[model samples]
Target chain A: MTSEFELIRNHFVRPTPQAILGPGDDCALIAPALGMQLAITTDMLIAGTHFLPDTDPCQLGWKTLAVNLSDLAAMGARPRWALLAGSLPEVSEPWIAAFTDGLFACASYYGVDIIGGDTTRGPLAFCLTAIGEVPIGMALRRDQALLDDDLWVSGQPGLAALGLAHLQGRTVLAEPLLKPCLAALQRPLARVELGLELRRRGLAHAAIDVSDGLLADLGHILQGSAVAAELFVAQLPPLPTTADPVLARQCQLAGGDDYELVFSAAPEKRAEITALADHLALPLWRCGLVVGAAPGQLTLLDDQGRVVPINEKGYDHFG
Target chain B: MTSEFELIRNHFVRPTPQAILGPGDDCALIAPALGMQLAITTDMLIAGTHFLPDTDPCQLGWKTLAVNLSDLAAMGARPRWALLAGSLPEVSEPWIAAFTDGLFACASYYGVDIIGGDTTRGPLAFCLTAIGEVPIGMALRRDQALLDDDLWVSGQPGLAALGLAHLQGRTVLAEPLLKPCLAALQRPLARVELGLELRRRGLAHAAIDVSDGLLADLGHILQGSAVAAELFVAQLPPLPTTADPVLARQCQLAGGDDYELVFSAAPEKRAEITALADHLALPLWRCGLVVGAAPGQLTLLDDQGRVVPINEKGYDHFG
Candidate 1:
């Protein structure tokens, strides 16, 4: 019988150049760069709850690391190492091989080392802890947003949600949009470069990754910074033209899993932000502005400056 | 409905003085001490696999962190920070409260700070990533043992298995031993102090924590170090005196879930090892010797110097 240890050694053990010690020992050893603080985050993905049981093992692996990397991006940290803890119902060599392939693909892309982790027999689930590094006291924080700061987002938001909707049969999309949306859902890129640039240039005052939709995740910043936000619905980036306007709006406002960074910056830094966007060749959308009104409150306005009613804020696992 | 976020904030969020940034952020921040390398490890515990579904939540929580801490102990590292990712089938305030309390209790004992993690709704499971620190190039490794090294084990090695056996109704234990045995199973200490001392004093050449039974875990060291071992079964530490001799032998040889440290040192260091053990007021059992025989080979010998027949090596999740 193949034991968990052999499975790990066969599939997950790889040469980790970044680590002083790697998978063979009890713990992997890493030496963070001088004058840098380690940034750490963990995320868990369950089979039925986080992904479809029939989902491709490769995509599942990619998404698991991608989501955790997104957290590092939000913190303006440089990805360094990760630990993956997974529970599998049974041993399937093919499944594990494909999963590790996809996982290492993303890790290689982001230049993050898979240092160490654990594997066991149980339900299908994955929990990844990503470690990164940032200059001391330079890591972005949710509670540092200043009132009157312009709220910005990287890349088009809500594409992953649309993909999920299509997969769930709640919506149907055609051609080019279908593939991109599905890719967004399956292999969303963490905005690591954008975050690093923002921090290195001292631009963003506060930031958060949009995992639980635009409004809900931004609300985290609002509550943390004790500020309110006013988002102009008309100014929001356009969704796929093929989607219905109402469904598009709902997806943009309340759907999760976008893995885009939403940040707040001083209005005076608009020129710098534009230059940074130009350098990265990624559109930086100015969607809203931080306000001093009721803390944690969010207001959405139409083109006519009238309030738009929102029934749901975002996805709630228990709700 | 109680959302995953609220559950985390209410139960898992706390003041983390050790971390530069704690929970409620995208990622927690920590600074390793100068000239130290960060040692990291992760472990996953799943319901019906790592623990019984009816197990106490508090004890489960303690064991979750304790097991991960044992990994750090084996590497002779000082525990620093941890990230916990968990999935729960349903929300239970009391259960979460008790679990976090027990987790924190163990963390406080080891001086580990809960930095950050994720919570989701799904089947009950937990994956914890623990970080520790050791001076550069000073970590104890399984591959460092040399031929003729004295193999030593800390504490009673089979008490946990005995406790589990009693709980499983495989054995009947008297009152005096029952509570302590159960405690050994449920709340086994990680032997962190001993590991630290061994590394600090430069006494041990190789070390590993006994999580998967002495023979199996020791086999890892032998294989990694490219050496063989001869274990004197009669010299093995005794379990509770009340345990049946045959059953105790089985537990000592093949049963798992003991968090004691097993290490190897040069034969000439025997006096220093004894002195250290005397200082700590803990028995250090010298039960085996590393040899230049076939790599990864292990032989068990009785008092009469005859080979002892072995059936099972250790617990194998898939086996």
Candidate 2:
């Protein structure tokens, strides 16, 4: 059996080219880029809570780190380094090997270095702390939204939720949709490039990642910026014809686990944003507009501009 | 009933004066001090493995962060911020309240900001990621021990192990030793100040914190620096006369959970180090000397210069 130290050395230790000192040290040493500020986020995943206990180790590893990178991406920061700490029930070298392969695969794709972390014996769980760099004073923030800014959401937001529903047998997704939906849920593609471009080109006034439902996450932005929003139900991306439209709309409005970026930009930048969408070959949906009504109030409007009633909010772990 | 967001905002959210942006955002923003490198470390504490599931919530909170800070102390870094991600079996308001109090107490005492984190539902566990700063090229390292340097240890090394032994009913502690031993086990003080002083004054060649037993942890330094050590058993801190000398000696030699720092310093710095002990008002014992021998070797010598044979190594989570 591999000892704890041997397990770490054999699996978790990797070349951290960007770190001044890496995994072997008591603490990894990283020099912040000149004139740049560090953005830090931490997320925890627990077995049975975050995923099924028997979920594939590889996908679990990818999703664990991907969720954290999504937060950094929302801040328009370049993902740089991460520290992973977790508790394992037992030592299974094959499971660990597969998990690390997926973890390193995500880290490699995102240009992040796995620097340092800790492992312990207990129920299965993982916590990841991701660090990224953004030019001083340029990172996007939820409180920076301006009244009348065009609210944009990158890519489809409900696919992950639908994928989860399919897995739970709540919905049977069409054969073609099943693959993409599961991919969205299991292997999220964080919008790092879009965030960077938006910040660099001065396109976004504020931003947030859509982890919770679109409405609930947008409520976070509205509450932070002290504004309201008028969302057009007609403008939301259409559900696939084969999927139940009501359930799909419910998932789009209030389902969680979508790692898409929801941002607000000046109305004048719509053309620039459209060009960016074409440039990145990703959809940028103009779904709403920031308004100046009661803070954190979301008004769903139809094509005829009539108010629509909706009840679903979002996921709260302790709710 | 308080939701997860409310629980966080009400308890975990503390003022982060040093942070550009504190909690409530997607990511917390911190500007690294100029000319300083960031030292980052992550540690996970599982209820059953690291502590009793029914242990005091307040102390558990303190130990979670303290262990991570101990890593920063080992690096001779000034702790700046921490991100705490954890899973709870259930939301017990009073338990969380007391836990946050202890957590914030340590963070406040250490001048660290609780920036951002995540909370999920699962078996109770915590992961703390601590970020500290050290002057460029000035952090203490394990691989810098010099031959003939004095090996010094801070504080009593085996009290925690004795405390564990007492708690497990393996040993009956005398009245006077009980409280102190329990405190040593439950509330360890990281030698942050001593580490800073050592690095700032260039007093130490290499350093590591004693989490594992003295011999086991010292072995890490030896292996890293490619040097050996000769420890005088008689010079080891004497066990109390009231306690079983054999068990006490065993605990002292091969016990774990001691957060005290063990360092190697040049022989010429003895006087300065003694002065430092006076300044800090802490015990600094000169226990041994780094030697030229087979790397990672530890030789124990008695008062009569005879070698002593010992079988106790250190605690390994998976061993």
Tens-digit lDDT string for candidate 1 (B235-302)? 89976689888889888888788898999999999999999999988899999999887999999999
Cα lDDT tens digits for candidate 2, B100-165: 988988898789999988887789888899999999999999999999999999988899889988
Q: Each model's TM-score, in the order given? A: 0.98, 0.98
Q: Output the number of the DockQ-best candidate.
A: 2
Q: List the residue pairs that clash in candidate 1.
A: none
The CA lDDT at A77 in model 1 is 97
lDDT tens digits by residue: candidate 1, A125-225: 99999999999999999999998999998888888889899999999988788898899999889999999999999999999999989988999999999
- Interface RMSD of the predictions, in order shown? 1.6, 1.3
Fnat of the models, one by one?
Answer: 0.88, 0.91
| Stretches of candidate 1 exceeding 4 Å from the true structure | A1-5, B1-5
Chain A TM-score across all models, in listed order? 0.98, 0.98
Question: What is the Å distance of residue B228 in model 2 from its true position?
Answer: 1.6
C-alpha-based local distance difference test score of model 2:
0.89
DockQ numbers for every candidate?
0.77, 0.81
Model 2 misplacement above 4 A: A1-4, B1-4
